[model samples]
Target: MSITLKLAWKSLLNRKTTALLTILTVAISVILLMGVERIRTQAKSSFANTISGTDLIVGGRSGQVNLLLYSVFRIGNATNNIDWKSFEEFSNHRSVDWAIPISLGDSHRGFRVMGTNHSYFEHYQYGQKQHLSLAKGEEFDGLFETVIGSDVAKSLGYDIGTEIIIAHGISDVGFSRHENTPFKVVGILAPTGTPVDKTVHVSLEAIEAIHVGWESGANLGNEPSKEQLLQMDFQPKQITAMLIGLKSKIQTFALQRQINTYKQEPLSAILPGVALHELWGMMSVAETALLIVSVFVVVAGLMGMLSSLLTSLQERRREMAILRAMGARPRHVFTLLVSEATVLTSIGIICGIGGMYAMLAIAAPIITANYGINIALSGITSHEWMLLGFVQLAGVIIGFFPALRAYRQSLSDGMTIRI
Candidate 1:
């Protein structure tokens, strides 16, 4: 066995340039394959964990997908607003534990602005039921005070006490830029790799405060000063959505039914877990397509290796003939060829794993900061192990092609061949 390995090792070193190139091709393909796998698994986990510990997400009557997108992802506009009365009714219900109302339709330099009570900071949870923690300062206490996410703070270079003027709509050049009631950044939340990292959080009153005196999507009356707006009524009459936490899991369905059938207002209550699963399910097709592409890429890399082995076989015929002259049997030639393939593949897999870790080390933080997906620098998962196993098995299987060809060649043919 050692002799065979030594022969294979020296043989590969004979065509060191080709061997190196083959290994690189395999390494790149492995990196891509493992990267897609990592992103797929981590993305699903990231989505599922975006909001946790909350039982249900309540919003105006709309599709479950719509509510999830607008309320949680801040992706689109709300279909309509839910009356504050309805929020109070369900929030005060016997089975309800906590409710955090959400108000949108405002932006600060292109960042979505969210409005909620202090309960948001207390009750809202993320991955593994982790609560949002302040990285720099405390939650907003005043109407004009705001708590920015990590991305927002870093992107806009905002720190505590940094004043920001919000626009009326989602656009940077919105309907009305509230120049009078500029909000001061009070807190900066640590990066959670979720939508919270991209949001600007303020009190519900602050949402109302900036829009005071606005009518028909424009300021029809004189705008109130920041001080005056703070003192006056800022109580929200309607909200875009709310996150609900039930006292007991048993009553979740009952409460959902009750809210859906509410006569006062049409509303939709969706279990966050169920909705999240459905959301991820909708994206599965794309994920599967990406995975297929990666698999093909790996196949291409293996095919390249096969081509290298076959081409090298043509050039190494004389070498094989010499070995046979030295009493090395055809079986020995076969073993050596197979061992060469195995060694090349083993080295490639090693380099691929090393490349993968290096990539994760460099990209994890960037991905977390931009997309809010905290890809952990973890070890190979079971699925990745399966992928690696497939690669190893394929390599050994591919070895047979070259090994068999060399085994069948007669010593006379190999030695007499001049070309």
Candidate 2:
């Protein structure tokens, strides 16, 4: 084995450039395949952890997907608002532990505006049931005071006491400005890796206060002036969605039934976990497609390695015959070729893993800022290690046939030059 290894090292050194290039090719392909798998797994985990401890999401009747998108992800606007009457009824239910009413539809420079009560800060949890923490200052204290999420604060460079105006609607453009009732950023919450990190939260009344003004841009002869609007009593009669945490999880189904059967307006209550599962079920197809593409890339890289090694064997025939004349067995010749391939592939796998970590380190901030996806660079998972083992085994197996062919040629040539 040692003699085979020694000859392998010498032979690979003779073709150092080709061997190294093949290694790099295989390494890069392995990196891409593994990186995609890691991102997919971690992304799903991150999504699942976005909302924790909330038993159900109660909102106006809409598609289940829409409810998940707007309520948990803050991705799109809610079609309709749940009446305050319905919110009250749900909150007062015997099975309810706490209800957090979330009113959306306003924005501050592209950041969604969320109107909720203090119960939001007190009851809402995320990422392994962790409570929201204040990064700076305190929670919103008055109607016009606002608490910013971590990403909002970071992106907008907001600090305590920064005054911000809420736009009248969701559109980044063509929205009435709330220049009259700008709110002060009184707090900044720590990162939660959830949609909450992208929201600007305030009391429900604040959302109503900002919209109290001229109608249809005609000033509505009855329109309230800026000062009058400021002094006007304001209360929100509706909210986008309500997150409910029941006193007992067992009562979840019963409460959902009650909400769905409400006599007045149509309403729906969905379990957060179940809804997330459905969302993932929809996403799995895309994930599988990506996985398939990555597998193809890996196979292509392996085939390239095989082709390169086979092409080099002819040129190395004379060198192999010389070694055979020096008392090397045909089996040793085979072992030497196989060992070189194995070593090259192993190096590629290691380099690929290193490359993945380096990329994650550099791209994490941008990814978090743009996609709100947090990817951690840590030791590879057991599954990934297993994958590496399989790749190495495949490299050896695939190289075996070429190695055997080279050995047979060297044996036939004996001590004479094949060329």
Candidate 3:
């Protein structure tokens, strides 16, 4: 075994460039495969953690999945708004444990602005029912005071006292500005790894205050400054969605049905887990496609390694004959070749894993900023470890073919040149 290993090392050294190139090819493919798997799994976990502890997400009449998408995930726009009266009714229900009203339809520099009541800080939870906590300053105390999400504060470089104006609509630009009403940043929430991290939260009254003076088609009149607008009434009459937690889990279905059949406003209530699962089912198709492509790439890389080994066999035959004359058996030659392949492939796998970690570390901020998805740098999961085992198995299987061919040739040649 030692002799075989020594020979394997020498042979790899002799064709260092070819061996290194093969390793690199396999390494890149492995990195991509592992990265895709990691991102897919982590993304699903992050999505699931977005609205933990909230039994049901109540909104205006729409598809249950759509409500979850628009309200919790910030993936789409709500088709309609739930009347404030209906939200109050739900909040005042006997089975209700907590209610957090949300008013959307505004953005500041591409970050969604969420207008919600102070109860949001108390009741809303994420990531295993972790309560929302302020990282700096206190929660919104006045209607004009804002509590920014972690991503918003970090990306915008805003501190506790920075003031911001909410846009009239969700447009990034070309919309009427709420020039008269600007909110002060009173607090910054800790990172929740959810859509909440990307939101700019303020009092629901702040949402109403921004749109009060400007009527539809009204020209941008010389409006009072933002400070003056703060002195005016800022009570809200409507909201985009509300999150409801029931005193008893059994009451969830009953309340959901009631919200869906409300007389005042057509509303929808969705079980967060069920809606998230449906969303993931749709997302899994893309994940599967990515996995397929990664498998193909890995196969191609293995084939490249095999082709390189086969092409080098001719040059290695003379060396093999010398070893055979030195009392090296054909079995030893076979073991040597297979071991070399295994070592090369294992190196590739290691490099691939290291590369993935480095890439994730570098791209974490960009991913969160652009897609609102947080890719955590947690240790490898069981599935990922299984993948590593599979890669090692594949390496051995692919290497066996070339090793067998080398063994056959060494045996048939009988220490004599056949060519």
Candidate 4:
């Protein structure tokens, strides 16, 4: 056995260049396959963590996914607003522990601005039920003050005390600017790897105060003075949505059912977990497609290994004859070939995982900045272990054809070529 391994190792070293190239090909493919799986799993986890500790998300009558997209992710505009009276009703319900109202439909420099009260910072949670905390300065206090998310502060170069103008509508450009009522950045939130990192938060009263004179989507003459608007009522008549937390986990469904059947207005109440699952369900098709592409890439890499082994067999014909003459059985030659492939594959797998960790460490910040997806630097998952096992198995299976060819050729060319 030792002699066979020594012979196999020397033969691979004899063709070191091709062997190294084949190993690298497999390494790159393994990196890609592992990366895709990692991203898929982490993306789902991040998505699920976006809204935790909240039992139900209440909003104006709409699809569950739609409400989750706009309310939690701030992706789109709400089709309608829930009446403020209704918000008060359910918020004060017996089963509800707390409610955080969310007012949408505003933007600043492409980042969505959210209107909520202090309960948002107190109740809203993410990434392991973690509460929102200010990285610098303090929460917004006055009507014209705002709190910026970590991504907003970093991307736009804004810090605490930087004044910003809010746009009337949600657009990157070509929207009416609310220049008359600029907000001071009073706080900057820590990075949460969730939607919170991309939002600009302010008081609900601030949302109402800014649009004081713009009742009909047009400024009614000049907008009100800061003092004048402050003197006027700042109570919001309607809100886009609310995040609800219950005192008891068992009452979550009953409260959600009550909110859904509220007669005061057309409303929808969706469990955050259920809604998140639905969103992932819609995205499963794309995830499957990515996995399939990665699998094919790995197959192509293994095929490259097979081709190299087959090509090297022709050059090793005399070597195989020498082995046969020395009493090395055909099965030994077969095992030798398989062992070489296994060694190459084992080395390739190690290099692939190493490369994956290095690339993730480098690209994590960029992905978080551009796509808001956080890829964790954690150990391999069970699914990934299975994938690696399958790849190793595939390498052995690919080696079979080459080993069989060598076995048959050695029998025919015993001591010398039959031709």
- Structure candidate 1, residue pairs in collision: 193-372
What is the lDDT for 149 in model 2?
96
Q: How many residue pairs clash in each candidate?
A: 1, 0, 0, 0
State the displacement of the C-alpha of residue 390, model 4, in Å, after optimal TM-score superposition.
1.0
Q: Which predicted model would earn the best TM-score?
A: 1
Reference-based TM-score, model 3: 0.94
RMSD of 4: 1.7
Clashing pairs in 3: none
List lDDT for all candidates, in order.
0.90, 0.85, 0.85, 0.90
The C-alpha TM-scores of every prediction are 0.97, 0.95, 0.94, 0.96
lDDT by residue (1-419, candidate 1, tens digit) is 59999989988888889999999998988999999899889988899889999988999889898899899988999888999988998899999999999999988887899999999999999999999999998989888899999999999899998999898888777457888888899899998889999999999988877877897568876888877876786668999999999899999999999989989888999988888888888998999999999999999999999999999999889888999989999999999999999999989999999999899899998888767787988889998999999998898889999999999987777567888
Candidate 3 per-residue lDDT, tens place, 164-241, comes to 877866675645667556688999998877888889998887777677666762435655666776688756788999
Where is model 1 more than 4 Å wrong at Cα? none
lDDT of 2 by residue, 359-405 (tens): 88888778878888888887899999988888899899878978889
Clashes of 3: 0
Of candidate 3, the 10-residue stretch with the lowest lDDT total is 216-225
Compose the digit string of candidate 4's lDDT tens values, residues 156-207. 9999889999987776454477877789999999999998999999999999
For model 2, state the Cα shift of residue 303 in Å.
Answer: 0.8
The local lDDT score (0 to 100) that residue 373 gets in candidate 1 is 80
Instruction: Please identify model 4 stretches exceeding 4 Å from their true place.
Output: 172-175, 411-419
